[model samples]
Every structure is written in structure tokens, then in C-alpha cells.
Target: MSAHSWDVRRLPSAEGRSFLVTGGNAGIGYFVAEQLAGTGATVILGSRAPAKASAAARSIGGRVPGARVRHVPLDLADPASIVAGVAALRLESLDAVVCNAGVLLDHPPRRETDNGHELMFATNHLGHFALVSWLAPLLAAAPAARVVTVGSLTAKSVTLDLEDLQSLRDYRPKRAYARSKLAQMLFGFELDRRLRAAGASTSSVVTHPGGALDSLTPSRPVRSRTAGELLRGLPAGLLVQGKEAAAWPAVRAVLDPSVRGGQLWGPRVLGLRGRPVPEPVRGDLADTALAAALWAASADLTGLAPAAAGPAGA
Candidate 1:
């Protein structure tokens, strides 16, 4: 189908394919998983909470009959947990992985992971960096596998300080969150560059949800928003969108054949609310030098060398 003709409600079929979506237990992640399940593909929900993941899986099954869905424990903040999660998947190949899990701290003193990285940066960027590095082999095994990184509009306003990625010098909650997302976006672009350089079949793609509000989301078995809540959210809905709509860009990135690596997918209207489309890569996200620096820093911090795509089954 043409890019202009792409339809969110009627997605292309992906039968026999398999995908993994991190943070698939709630919010926009849940909707991404649900939509993918509707496409007749096996969907694995990667999350820190087993019960929540299982519940999300059940919810998908309930909504889409014969949906192939399951859960794997994955805590992005913990490298060991990521290692365990990939092992638990036990897959010879994977078609795509949506790096959708992230933390946005609204308030408080700054927090750090067990490895001493800032909480937002650790979970939002570094954890996925490490996870993708480990999954390189599995991704290589598939035909044209994709790593879809879900970024945020917040990154457009913030800047990254390579010297202090963890914000050890000055920690403000929103700035830290935005910077972490910026790093994630940069990582996506850099990963595509490296993949192309290595002649790897696996491609990296980046996308942003635009403005997403839970209050505007459709009711689901897992979490239902009251009518009153939706009514109150109507005003914001004009500027923003529900979590279901927010999942569109990432979902399109995963399934759209026309989408290419190094492209940025986002909302079409004012970049805030509308159907997903390819958007211009601007600002820091377009800075290759900055991305290269972030990639190097990520490798050093995560203690993971970039994984080259080896021969299938190698």
C-alpha cells in the first residue's frame, strides 16, 4: 500500500510473524500490543511485572479472538533482568521489538538504578540499548527485522549533555526525562547508521506518540476510563490524543513496509494529533555527531559492544 493510503484501523496482516513490545502491560504500550495481536501475529508482552503482563495478555485475547499473546519478565532498569528476559523468550528469530517502556518522573529528588545511572536515563535509553545489543542475534536470524524505538515530543525541546548523561551535576525531573528521550531518539538513528554500515538486515526505526492522555483513551478490561473522565478530557483531546491513538506511530513503524530505517514517524496534524506519517528529522535528533557520541557513551555505560548481525543460526 502507498504511504498516503496507509490505514491505522485496517492494518496489514502479519500472520506467522512475531513481535515483542516492552512495557506492554499498560498505557500506550497496551494499545500497541492489542493492535498487533489483531493482526494475527504472536505478540509477547515484555514487562517487569509478570501478573500485569499476563493480565494484559488475557485482555488482548478477550478483545481479539485467537490472539497469540504471552508475557516475559523484563525490567529495563536492571541489566540482569534484561538478560534474563531475553533468555526467557527462547526465540530463534524475532520480526520486531518496540522499545516502548519508559519512566517519566513528575516530581521528587533524583533516583538512580542499582548500577548508579539516573532512573529515567537508565530505563528509557540504556536498558533498551543493552537489550537490543543482546537481541541482535535473534533479530539477525529474521528477514528484515526491525527495532522500533518509541521516542517523545519532549525531546524536541531538551538537549543532551554527553558529560553528564545521568544528570549528576543538576537534576530536574522534566528536563531529565526529556534528555533521556532525546538520547533514545539519537540511539535509534545511530543504530540504523551502524546497521547499514554492517550490512545488517535488521533496521532501526524511531517514532513519537505526540500528545497522549490516558483520560482520553478508550475503555478496556484492563483499565476503564469513566464517561465523566472522557468528558472532562474532551477539551484536551482536541490538542492531544488517547493512548490508543498514540500507539499508531510505533505500530506503523513496525508494520509499514514503506517505512525506512532512520525515518521519524509521528502524528500528521501539527505533530500532536492525527494519523501517523513520516516526519522530518530535525533538531538534535538529526545530529549524527551527537548520536555517535551518545552511542559510544551508551556502550561504555552498558558494557556492551555493538552487536554485528552474524549469519542466521550462527
Candidate 2:
């Protein structure tokens, strides 16, 4: 909770805690798992590819001897994959679930998920929405559980369509990405409200790794070598922050007991990147009506009603 120092080494010990991180094979997600596992927390990394997830688990183990790390194959692009992934997770009590799996494909043809929803929307928002709903019971069983949704800075600039949650009319990649992130933000806040209404102890918090540079990020099996070449070509100062630094907010959101439900954390700078801090949620992102509508729409699309379920398995 010290504002002066919020780096990974400053994190508290997590001896008995457990965490699940989606897209944990690379980028911010990978580092989040690393940081958590380094502090003695048991971590399950959910990823689309088996080999990559295994590699990440190995990397964590290599970096921190005796680090408890495992991998659960999870593909956010497909609903069946998500269900199977959750079922495969046999943890007794999950302290936190980090919804970090996402896609940032640009200018590609408009695509749809196996369920016929917009690709980005389904992967970035709907999948996590369903995952959290199914795992609510496990979370509630913990003394203090958290559902951390990864949002993006682009959400601040976009306008969402309540009626057209899917990009049926217009399908530009940038717009779709922005709107999808906005949906995620809304879902996280709305989930907090619902959990509170149900008298559940689990908290729903949202966080964003502001302007993180993939160029400086530790390359993983999933990240393409050419992906950050362009950014590396530019002056290093143009980079807002490295992926490790970017991951601090998310790590804090999961491990910091002081982080409350409906609260958001981001970079200390203009969301570009520095140490983790409490970043104000913009008016649009804080709209109650929008959050409610997004929640309903997500439920409808995923066929999973948001509900507080039974206590964790123990």
C-alpha cells in the first residue's frame, strides 16, 4: 500500500494463496503470474496453447526455485474450450482470477467466434464474463477473493452501442477493440455491484497496463519476434513503459488487500506507465446504466446468468 514503492520485490508473501491468470503465457499476464508465484502463491496459467503455457510454467519455475506453477489449456475464442478449461482446474480455493486473455488483431476481416459473436468481443469480454460466473463459488469460499478484469486505455475514447454489442453494422478493428475494452470495464464494475447485492465477500476489480511496450517485454513462446520490431526501431523514450512495469497494477489488484470492489488501478503517469496507483474511472466508464446493460448483454451472449453460487470446494 506504500505509494513510494510498488515494484514486484515489494509485494507481500503469498504462501497459502492461489491465483488463476488467463493468457498467462506471455505479456502482462505472464509477468503477473511470475510475480505472484515468486512470492509463494500457487498459480494456474490459462492459455490457448499447451506448449506455450508449459513453457511459461517452466520459465517461472526456472526463475524462482520451488515456484508452484501449473497450466490449464484455455482458449477464449471458443466457449467449449472455456468450459473444459474451468473443469480441468481442480484447485480447492481460488483467491483470485485474473481475466487477462485478449486479442488485439488489427484490420483483419470481421470475424466471429464459434458461438457466432464478434471475435474480439467474445474473446476479450464475454469469455471472461462466463468464466467468472462459473467460478464465483470457488471465489466466494475464500476469506477474501477477487475477480480482476483487464481493461485498456482505449476504452476511454470509444462510444459503445448497447443495442449492437456485436459489431454487425460496422466492424473496424480499432473501434471493435475499444468498444470491447469498454464492455470489460463495465462488466467488472457491474459484477462488483451484483456481488455486493448477493452479500458475497468476493470483490470485482478492474485494472489496465497502460501503454505497455511489447518491445521491451520479455519474449515468450506466443509473442512473435517481429511484433515489437517497429516499436524497437523508434526512440526508447517513446515507450511508455515495459511490460513488467505495466503488470504492477494488475498484480496489486489481485494481492493488495486494500484494493476494494469497483476500484480501478493503473499507471501513476497518464496511464502511460510508472508505478501502480488508483486511477480515476472516467464518467462513461462509471455509468451505472451502461454497466447494467453490458452485464445483461454479456449474460445473454454467453448463456450464463451472473449469480453468486455455493462456497468454494474444500
Using TM-score, give the best candidate's number: 1
- Model 1 lDDT vs. the true structure? 0.92
lDDT of 2 at 274: 78
Residue pairs in candidate 1 whose N, alpha carbon or C atoms collide under 3 angstroms: none
Query: What C-alpha RMSD separates each model from the true structure?
Result: 2.2, 3.1
**Candidate 2 ranges with C-alpha deviation above 4 Å:** 5-7, 218-234, 310-314
lDDT of 1 by residue, 1-314 (tens): 56689999999899999999999999999999999999999999999999889889999999999999999999999999998999999899999999999999999799999989999999999999988988888899999999999999999999999999999887899999999999999999999999999899999999999999989999888789988898899999889999999999999999999899999999988899989999999889999999999988888788785454322123
Error of 2 at 92 (Å): 2.0
- The alpha-carbon deviation from the true structure for residue 135 of candidate 2, after best TM-score superposition, in angstroms, is 0.5
Which candidate number would show the highest lDDT if scored against the true structure? 1
TM-score of every model?
0.97, 0.92
Please, what are the lDDT tens digits per residue for candidate 2 over residues 31-137? 89988998899999999989989988998898889999999989987878877887888876789999998998698698998679899999999888878877877
Cand. 1 TM to true fold: 0.97
Off by over 4 Å in 1: 309-314
Model 2 residue pairs with clashes? none
